[model samples]
Target: MGTRLVPSGRTATRLLQAAIGVVLVEGLLLQNPGVVVNALLSLGVTFLPPVLARDWEVRLDTRLTLYIAVAVFLHSVGMLGFYESVWWYDHLTHTLSATVVAGVGYATAKAFDEHSDAVHFPGSFLALYVLLFTLALGVFWEVLEFGARLLATAVGMDPILFQYGIDDTLLDLVFNTAGAVLVALFGSGALRPLVESLTTRFDRSFGER
Candidate 1:
């Protein structure tokens, strides 16, 4: 079966939350309150897009919301120890993170155009920008992970709390690129609608320009 390019509707959102809920429960059982906190923070980010609801152009749509939800859910599960048990969990989360951030970048650019009435980028150019933006963010994320690992060691916590081995790090980058390219290629159809229409415009306002 073909994978759903973008998950639509509220049902998908609920499923994402449910999955995370399961992971969160597991974390609680394991007596790791920090894991629960991380889970909540992740969920909070997923829901934060609505704060921009006053501007319809940049408001997160169902697809982007679901993307963020899934990425966070996967990461939460990994935090709760599923990444080691399930094996594919970390790979999937990295790939999903790349795609999610790139989609958000694309939507933000489109929203800026609506506000500034500036010249708009064509679909491909927008996709490239999103791809690069996502990759840069992904790299920065890895850096944070590195820093977390160091801090953990300094404090006598798990030195690998946020760090992965070189192979895992390289794999994450590779998966990130794969996800970015997928969005850059298929995003016009799959990712664009996550940006809601401005008051007077079509669902997309750039195709004719």
Candidate 2:
């Protein structure tokens, strides 16, 4: 399983990078600097962790890297204006991103965890941990969105906040939670093994904080 994953993981990573490059060019041609900003920011968010992981001596497999890229790819499309034109695009992206967030949290928890550790707990506690982790990240994202708006206002650009109103914000949170719970309840079983393998291959893991 591990051997099969490594090759496909690299393919996914390259495909994602190429697709994002296309999005970048598309953003540039449209002269929509905001889209360009969003795309670059998305790419940074997608890839920066792996870059830092290398320096920090933490393991990040190409499959996980591709997952991040897929999450950001959804955002790149949203930045291109599908979030407005398509009634459901916003929902889809939020759900996808939130699920990815949960995946990362699960991987991180698994990487750092030792059954022998005093901080470790069994059963529902781990599920709860992932849920809370996802929710906290969702809120943090909202905060960043608002912060970006504040910065935009200070720079004299139109505030992008509240574009979809309070309903948008609330719905985003709802979807985020839903995604997290779905992953916790179902997806984790399949994903955990792959993540465990990746972390083991690297031979580096985070300690409980």
Candidate 3:
């Protein structure tokens, strides 16, 4: 039998339906239109990439990617609300951290699968890779933020709008590194088996075996 394929349109439609369901659930539970709308919007944005990239060559699992994206989006939104400001630094840091974790997690999973025949790298090495990549991403984000601020200034917008002090940037890097380490230590072990099981079940359900 040939591999079963899920049509991209079907994937998109399913994600949209799921978002609507979340909105309905939120409305029923909280009776708050604002909360419901926010949840739907967040879900839509989080699922959009995976739904669109359903046929892409990327080995990242769509379901896991969507879950991580939603969690990151919600976390960033919460931070913005808590800080009472949408500073460029805050947004950049959050985006960097989220992207790093998701990217590293996906890459690590692939590496683990490929290296299954080889001796497994010590968990410490995996943790180090996660931290290093996250730190690198942090630096890249800072550079982007700086460039954005410079562009805003040149365009006669408030340069202060994107000014992320060195101290704040460093703090963000620290937190991002911490988050990466935690994900490596906990998420690696927890999510690996779960993803493997899900992948096996998905293949079996679709008669891809």
Best model number under lDDT: 2
Candidate 3, residue 27: Cα displacement in angstroms equals 23
A best-first ranking of the candidates according to their TM-score comes to 2, 1, 3
Prediction 3 TM-score vs. true: 0.54
- How do the residues 1-39 of candidate 2 rate in per-residue lDDT, one tens digit apiece? 322337777677667777777788898898766677777
Alpha carbon lDDT of residue 17, candidate 2? 70
Listed in order, each prediction's TM-score against the native is 0.76, 0.78, 0.54
Model 2: what TM-score? Answer: 0.78
Q: Candidate 1, residues 78-106: lDDT per residue as tens digits?
A: 78677777778888888888887776677
lDDT, candidate 2, equals: 0.71
Candidate 3: the clashing residue pairs are none
Name the TM-score of candidate 1: 0.76
CA RMSD (A), model 3: 9.5
**Which of the predicted structures, 1 or 3, would earn the higher TM-score when compared with the native?**
1
- Candidate 1: where are CA atoms >4 Å away? 1-8, 54-58, 113-118, 159-161, 196-209
